[model samples]
Target: MRRIITTIDIGTTAISTIVAERQKDGGIRILGVAQGPTFGMRRGSVVDIDEVTVSLKKTIQEASKASGMNIKKAVVGVGGTHINTYNTKGVVAISRADGEIAEEDVRRVIQAAENSIPKNPNREIIHIIPREYKIDNESGIKDPVGMTGIRLEVDAMIVDGSKSALRSIIKCVEGAGVEIDDFIFSSLASAEAVLSRRQKELGVMLLDIGGGTSNYSVWEEGRLVQAGVFPVGGTHITHDIAVGLQVHIDTAEKIKLEYGHAIPELFSKKDVIKLADFGLNGDDVYLKRHIAEIVEARFKDIFELASKELKRIDRFGLLPAGVVLIGGASHIPGIEEIAKKELRLPIEVGKKVNLPQPTDKNLQELLFTYPVALGLVAWQVNQLSGDNRYFYNPTFESVSSKIKNWFKVFIP
Candidate 1:
């Protein structure tokens, strides 16, 4: 029997679902992918349950039809302004008479580190990434299994999200008749699909700019160190375009795609683009430089916010691999140039090279936009049988459920 796996990403602008089959050779093949306009979601969080549920049902149903699979369970992607991350450390003593550290000892140390964080009723831990381990004061141990040490220590990064926001996501998915196998942060998932081993080890930052929110993840020394979400994204840019050009949002989005560039100086004032089709004057001509100016402003703001997060962790100039950009907004022209200028760092756009290309060429390009969905499948496969290279702690144990069924809402 073919092992069927599905991943669902409910974003502010769209609901994307990817259904894949695990091949006999331990590879994944794309079976179906559905990308539909999202409704009732704002800044990556569900706002209207009924509307979001309807969109989710439609997206999953389309994928189900294409793949001919029921897709009862899925690994979901969640991110928004409510997401947060911080560094934490956990320590524990080996519970064996021989002082040998076993797998359980490693889990205990990670659990201890997770427990170090203050409990917040409103927040729920989403990811616990072990940075490094120390055994018997010998520091910098990456793996502690099968080692002899009386004392074990682990430094990890804890990713958390709003409890209310998480519950809302769960409700939407369950309403769609899909069980949630696990929930991964959108930026982390994107990093899995785009970031390289060298980038993670040498230090790199990833930004996944969706329609309503921009999510970021920083990896250094082969570990995720920081992650966050900004309330601003492509949708905000479209709104700005609409307000500035006196056009409808749909038209502004089209113009932004067709004419917008992040670095205004690269374009000429004399070079004008006609927007007569968008209800502009009969001789409607807009200075390309002016459109670029608006694009540059918001993009600068995004980089500035990202800079603040890097500054907080003292990683502004510390990352040698620099910044990697992904998501829908990253497609905007001249964004890399503007990011390089504004952030004063090397910049490159992230691509979905890690995944196997779909048989349909058009669907292969969809991987770039729907990377989180792909990463969700990758993470699940890895968790089930593949070596646990990424963060694999199943659920946060310290924070008690604020609402009944909150933690178990998606479980079958």
Candidate 2:
């Protein structure tokens, strides 16, 4: 059985796409991967449908050329400030003559959790994942089916997003001539590619720092505990540089990528370079230390908020596996030190993908940054195999292929 899936991860700065062929052993072999410019988006939400649609089309076409595979449908990853998460519990009476909780009981309790969601037509629930189960006096149960209990309960993590924002993204994908097979929260998708089961079980935090927003999620005892999106991201650093140096946005971006450092102390007073040295201008000269200072302050703005959020949950410095940083912005040279100093935890940039991956040199080196896109393809494989320990996948039923008889379901 062969299962090939394509995925698109839309960020404020860029759009990432992946075409992968799932092997018989349930591993992903990347056929194609590409990164393209993103426009008409801010903080992960679509601001201009027309601009995003055009960008999506070009990115998909590029991926097709790279993989030599026709791209038609894709699993999309969604994240932004408009997305919200809640930790909630649901209760129900078990329906069994022997007082044992049945499969239906579990389903009913989960539905009850969904019912706890506040009624907002403007918002749609995208993920309703079970955190733990409780049977009467017993709590912290991972699985409750067939357990003897009169009362059944479930603690679930619910993620919902602005309906209008989601619609705008869907319209852009469809406008690009690609059907949406399924949609997932961006952080959840990243977790699939970089986070391991051991990390989840021991407690870990993943921060996916993008251009416009920093998306973070927490897992404890192998369940989603908390998650959120911060409006601040790497773009803030670019803006700081542009304002400080009186440079254009494009120049600021280039400087940030090529010479930006998170720690100012790493540079010396004599370590200065002129614009002409970077092929920009012949006269203007600046200190690299100054550039690093601008970058550090903007990052402080991001990490301060993150620290506050961790304090709210009482998980600061608590995760044994510490913090795993992914996404495009996390690729900066000395970011882990900043993360460690502010977060006060053991921090390491996420690398070393577990998937049976592509051999392209650039794509192989960039695999860490493409977790969300890679995870979307992995999501499809997990769906077929009933692997719910990582993410509870809601069916992506709309515009799904009308015929499903061609591929045999491969279960590992």
Candidate 3:
């Protein structure tokens, strides 16, 4: 039987599973998908182990049933404030073997770089992405293999996360009876879904506004430049609306989705919405301006947070392709306009590609919310088939081994 790859995205508000089969043409055929309301997670961190396990099993079982395949292993996405990155450097004496560099040389240099990472008890390195490689006196070489050099140097960005957080996610998957092939950063996964080759080459920022958190990844010259996660997200907006309008959380959420606009003027004053629950006098009371104000205030705050993050990275005006917004909160009306105004760059809503055409256009419109889930599936397929197109290097075995060692040091 042909093997299939599954990906489970246990996000802040939802757990989604996707199954895909490798195709002959090096592409993926999505076999099935399932999503359910997430439990035991808040702001992208696993909190309740049992709740997360139940949700994971339910979503996985649904997807497995649809695909008619038993998924035993998967690539999962991890994101939270605990995720962090730092720069590290490594140098190695190039062996004089016909004056040519080999893959092993590059791998050794990476391992040397990995040595620079501090063995923190609470954190483990998740990924080591080379920013640039230098061979002898030559600088800015992306690939060192097959090059002629006496000394090799490398600068890499090391991504690390809290050991407890990672262990929680791993335990949840194991409890669900699924093996974790790999754990990908949530922002990185979202970047894979919406960022184009040109965008990465030219420099771009991917901002995924999820239910309980907003994650960001910066790409420049076709490499991951930086990544981060903020605790604020769509849930904050709902909370603001609920408090401002004196309505229940569910009602506030519905109001935000149905009539929310980042810009108040985007919704006309004459266009009124009835709020039966929030009304002070009557059930049919209408308040168009009030709702717009509440949404606009929350959106402005979210955009301002994004702006601060961009400015802190000094990439506010540097990204050639600007910002690509994905995830559930990106569905808010006028969000693109808000991003453009706040970030002072081009903004567009990101959508998931490589999916079958849906009969319902409305459902198609909602696909952008599933970018992380879809990207997880894409990452899983790449891992299963040894596709290194997404990463700078392609070998999973070497990478996994390095991470395993790092995990041991971190957890111990």
List TM-scores for all candidates, in order.
0.92, 0.91, 0.89
Residue-wise lDDT of candidate 1 within 1-412, one digit each (tens)? 7788899988899989999876666567788999899999988888899999999999999999998888898888988888887888988989999998898888888889877888886777887888889998798777888989789999888888888888888788889998777778888888766777789999999988889999888888887778889889999999998898777899889988888888788877688877776665677677888889999999999999999989988998788899998888898999998898777778998764554323334434766678788777767666656555557452433222333365666446
Estimate every model's Cα lDDT from 0 to 1: 0.82, 0.81, 0.77
- Candidate 3, residues 46-151, lDDT tens digits: the string is 9999999999999999999988989898888888878887888999988767869887788888888888766776676777788889987889887788889789
Once superposed on the true structure, which residue ranges of model 3 sit more than 4 Å away at CA? 268-270, 277-286, 352-367, 384-412
Model 2 Cα shift for residue 146 (angstroms): 3.3
User: How far does residue 95 in candidate 1 sit from its true spot (Å)?
Assistant: 1.8
Give stretches of model 1 more than 4 Å off. Answer: 279-283, 355-364, 394-412
Candidate 2 wrong stretches, greater than 4 Å: 355-366, 393-412
Return the TM-score for candidate 2, rounded to 2 decimals: 0.91
**Inter-residue clash pairs, candidate 3:** none
Q: How much is the lDDT of residue 84 in candidate 2?
A: 93
Report the poorest 10 consecutive residues by lDDT, candidate 2. 399-408
lDDT of 2 by residue, 1-412 (tens): 5577899999998999988887777666778888899999999999999999999999999999999998888889999999998877789998998998877887788878877766775666778788889999999999898789899988888888887788788779989999887678888887877788889899999988888999998888888889889998889889999999888888888889889898999899999867786677569877889999998888888888888989899999999999998876687778889989999988988886644333334434656668788767767778767665445533323312211211123212
Q: What order do you get sorting by TM-score, best first?
A: 1, 2, 3
